[model samples]
Target: MDENCDYIFKGYTPNFTLQEDDIRAIQALYGGKPSKSFSSPLSNSIETYQAVSKQMAPSVKSSNKNSALCLDPQFDAIITIDDDTYIFKGI
Candidate 1:
């Protein structure tokens, strides 16, 4: 039981392990090979963000759209771009 528990914690069932057929069935259903790494979700988020930012760098640098700035009575300032408005409070 202890050995089986250890196997389960390490990410596989000892008695009911996946065969080649089971792996193929999973790939057919999911459309991609399963990842072998056991990385944390936070690391995955950072990796995804870095990849997206690299792809967006060129377009972001070439953008010429200007934002309009104005002071609000309640907030410190307001920045307007297209139909969106962002307010900065306190400072």
Candidate 2:
């Protein structure tokens, strides 16, 4: 078992002994490609975030559009200030 291999998915802990096919299938069902650094905790978080963020972008965009300031819905917009921050106004 790889000492650095640490991942949690769907409420189940990952088995470090997982085969290549298992990893591929998991990636297909979820949304990440296997990486050599998959064994690293930081890499795992980054990959998980990337995968989930892609899945969330559409819905978040739509919600932002519909939830903008009512008086200036056309003018209001969601602004990404940075990776960790955003500016949005709601009615």
Candidate 3:
């Protein structure tokens, strides 16, 4: 896929917790962390970002079956900033 063609979604939801398992799953398919680098606007409150950074573990359980985040087994996925999701064509 063309790098520039990738879509960008926005927002931040502490509840859309992404964990190591998900990262590992992606790594198994595409190798480490894809091609993207972590580059958020640092100008925001450092404390705010640091707080959110700490929330990636202890995944939000799937028990919330009604959770709005749709999971498509066909494509690899990433939790967008909001607890919503982005399904991608994984390699």
Better of 2 and 3 by TM-score: 2
Q: What is the C-alpha lDDT profile of model 3 across 1-91, one tens digit per residue?
A: 6744676544345677657797788889888753777666764666565566556434676667543333322334455657876665433
- Backbone clashes, each candidate: 0, 0, 0
Q: How high is the lDDT of residue 89 in model 1?
A: 57
Instruction: Compose the digit string of candidate 1's lDDT tens values, residues 1-91.
Output: 6642463223234687677887889989987754685767788787777677556554333333322111122454567779999866553
Per-residue lDDT for 88 in model 1? 67
TM-score against native, each model: 0.22, 0.23, 0.21
Look at candidate 1 and give me any clashing residue pairs: none
Best-fitting candidate, scored by TM-score: 2
Misplaced by over 4 Å in model 2 are 1-39, 59-91
Q: Please state every model's RMSD to the true fold in angstroms.
A: 18.4, 17.0, 15.6
Give per-residue CA lDDT, model 2, range 13-86, as digits (tens). Answer: 55646778988888899979555544666777877776775565544334455543432323323444457654
- The positional error of residue 71 in candidate 3, measured at the CA in angstroms, is 30
